[model samples]
Target: MEPLARRTLLRSGLLVAATAVAGPALLTGCGSGEESPARSDGKPRRGGTLRAAFTGAGAGETLNHFVGGTALDMVRARALHATLGDLDPSAPDGVRYGVLETIEVNGELSAYTLRLRRGLTFSDGSALTARDVLWSLRSPAEDPASLPVYKNPAATFDFAGARVENDHTLVLPTLAPVADGRLLLCQGNYLVVKENSDFSPEVATSGPFRLEEFVPGEGCALVRNEEFTHPELSDAPYLDGLELRSLPDSEARAAALTGGQVDFAHDLSPVTARTLGEDERFTLTSTSPPYVSGLFFRMNLAHEPFRDNRVRTAFKLAADREAMVESVFFGDATVGNDLLSPGFPDYADEIEQRPFDPDRARRLLREAGAEGMRVTLTTGPETPGMVEVATLYVENLVAVGVDATLEELPAGQLFADYPAYTRLPLAASFSVPTPALPLYQMSYGGQNPAALGWDRPDVDELVATARGTSGEESARAGLAAQRALWEEGNTIAPVFKPFTTAHVPGISGVAEDLFEQFPGFSRATLS
Candidate 1:
């Protein structure tokens, strides 16, 4: 299929095969139990600097990533510090342990134990122990220096009751029964640091790479910890050095890759992914499902017409999910089922798919006395897919006799003011990949502002039940809550698109790391 014309996005309405051009079908699961395709030239090459281009690597960049607001910030954090772990459903305990070996939770889910791997050391030659972990987790909340990502560790876990039994062991006590404590603790925010030590770039960190040089808004250089070795992180620090360059523009990121200035481009637009993927010189990889962002639209209950369930149902029914995935993403994404987390254990995949039925939608609107209702869909390029998806959805709404128009906002301004954002009758947004229950609790459940007044006490109880238990009991309650939300929720989530990266042929480790969104070169190589 011919590639969609550059940036025009709406030329002949031809849907191209996005993945067909996304290099070879290597089937990399991006750390959810799939191997990255090996470099064609056999054994892994030993040492060279690997350059990567990503946006938000600007002047505001900080080495302390507790409040990382950009992709590059988190990228640097993962590179410079060893993390607790990452949420990986494929793992037996739903996590991939990093510096710490295991997180054992008791039956009631209130008590927990953290066991660190023995013999871990920092770049400054300090022995990494449980005391370091205790300080790092508590000090953030005490001084209140951390950001939104740091909230869970501070708020959920009871640090006051946490005690260190020995150098390698820390026992934690939680305020309540929590089944997914491991996920919360190991979600990359928790790190180890010396007691009472400020997180200075000078201190020995948890990662295998040491910072060599840093210049805000431009880039930074990192040197490998020559003695660093990780049992699970594949051949880490294999490269002698790494360079990160900041290029905020998608076009510029792609240009850098094609121009030989950068060996890898992070988070390209689907259009660029398809274009570069078609080139034989580069290999395209995406983070796996349940890890990708799920695009959604929330119809505020406080808004006119939406107060009527039929109108909300009609608006959802009007969307043509398949066409949006094809035309907007060029078939790079999967169609959402008016719900998020398509493949998660808690996701209600067995539920019937929502269908596109303009006829039914029109009848429902007429029944609700909402025929010819005028609603402005507030959209922006929050992600490459948001505006395009809104455009197509509005067209579908118009087909059902609703006067729907797209109101595009400048990038970064969409959620800059939360009040104005949530006040819109129709808001278009997308959520980064997160576990099912916590994601809803954080964004869509209860009276959360992002929920847009979706208040359902029963659903909340179901979720609470699900979150407090495990195995079959949790699944049953979680599915019950999700099924209710799927049938009547105010949000219209229609597709989940992966975070994509494209690299030159010699790039071998981009898709193997557990943190697939911002890949690390600890295992990457140059030709």
Candidate 2:
């Protein structure tokens, strides 16, 4: 089975995998039963310097992960930009206020009344009000980069709009009773930025940290927000200042951590993590994030080999999932059958995974009359993990008699042609949130790789239906249908959920959630 000819595969299609993995209702039951801050034995102590390193040396734009979409940048964003509430990775749907004080969920769950914390203020002393929430939600929704990602959700106030009942209370109206709306609010996209605020280095916020400095694609420094309040975050963030430096490379970040140039590092590979974890001078905190890592099969029905379903199935069967996970992921990942991660509430447990059987793969290819095919895999230079994953894929495809080549480009260049890029029977890299909402929006939503033309009425209907309903049963049914659509179409191949391994030293509080979306920095205390 030769890989789909580069020209044949490049011929095109587009499909996006935009759904989030698990809803709060489903996750609450599966998460680790960790007690909240009030119950924790550790006490927060203010003030010290906390410098952290990213696998990449730094970030590209404002400390806005939503626009930039880098996990490293997100850590800083979480601290400077608080979400409407905090998504407790430990609790399935538990969303508590990071800046706001409390939220009253009505009996029907269709409406909510959010109360601002009494003395909450932006870093500049501007009082936080409903106006900020409204602006933050609306501004990004209107941003060009965000439209492709943030879709209309009945549960989130994203489209429905919020009404200010008073200075302290906000009337949040929703299309449906979103049991997990609070969790969605904690995502990188939905963060509550200040009203009329542009995320810039000079700006400041109400979170425990305030951005003191930022050098795009380089590093950032955050100092404590003296006005921060919250008993849960008491004495918190022992660090007087936190320096977020992005190294731009895993090797450099690891070296910095080991050499003591940096106190902490994020997104370290399994090998680097293991090495650092063994060192007594440092402590490792790792979480099985709700992110999915996988091979994206370009869905251009217009393309040659891809147009033949048999060819797609053959490649899917030929690739070795377990080997890739074990070899590339360092045995620290779970096999993905499709876009949905097990952590998501909408995940289909019944979906069968095609094992790594080259013979069967060959048979499928032969049956499809695919005598010889070739394809080019497109990925980014900064995607360290993808490079390794692509290498394994190439090796496996070659073993199964498929001819494949790897094309690595800069991160910016890859994303520019993301849609048409995948059409090349190419394997690309992506990590999305656990929710069906975010996942669906990025994959199959309007911006997906179905670059040529994609109009899956059935898929759209399922997603639309899910988006419309608020109840668990309806959501389950819609998600089931959506999952079926993904499986039936072979839009993208599931790979593994990578664990975020962090190395910390002289830090008393460094807890991580499975979502790996936000770092609980408010409670972090430097020893």
Q: Which candidate's TM-score is highest? A: 1
lDDT agreement with native, every candidate: 0.73, 0.58
Segments in model 1 whose C-alpha atoms lie over 4 Å from true places: 1-43, 57-66, 127-149, 153-156, 188-204, 215-217, 226-229, 233-235, 300-308, 363-382, 401-426, 445-452
Best by lDDT: 1
Per-residue alpha-carbon lDDT of candidate 2 for residues 364-440, written as tens digits (9 for 90 to 100): 78887775677776666344466677677777767766777778775434554334454555546555555665455
The window of 10 residues in a row where model 1 has the poorest summed lDDT is 6-15
lDDT of 2 at 336: 63
Give TM-scores for every candidate, taking all chains together and pairing residue i with residue i.
Answer: 0.80, 0.79
Predicted candidate 1 versus true structure: per-residue lDDT over 194-225, tens digit per residue = 56665565767767688776665656677787
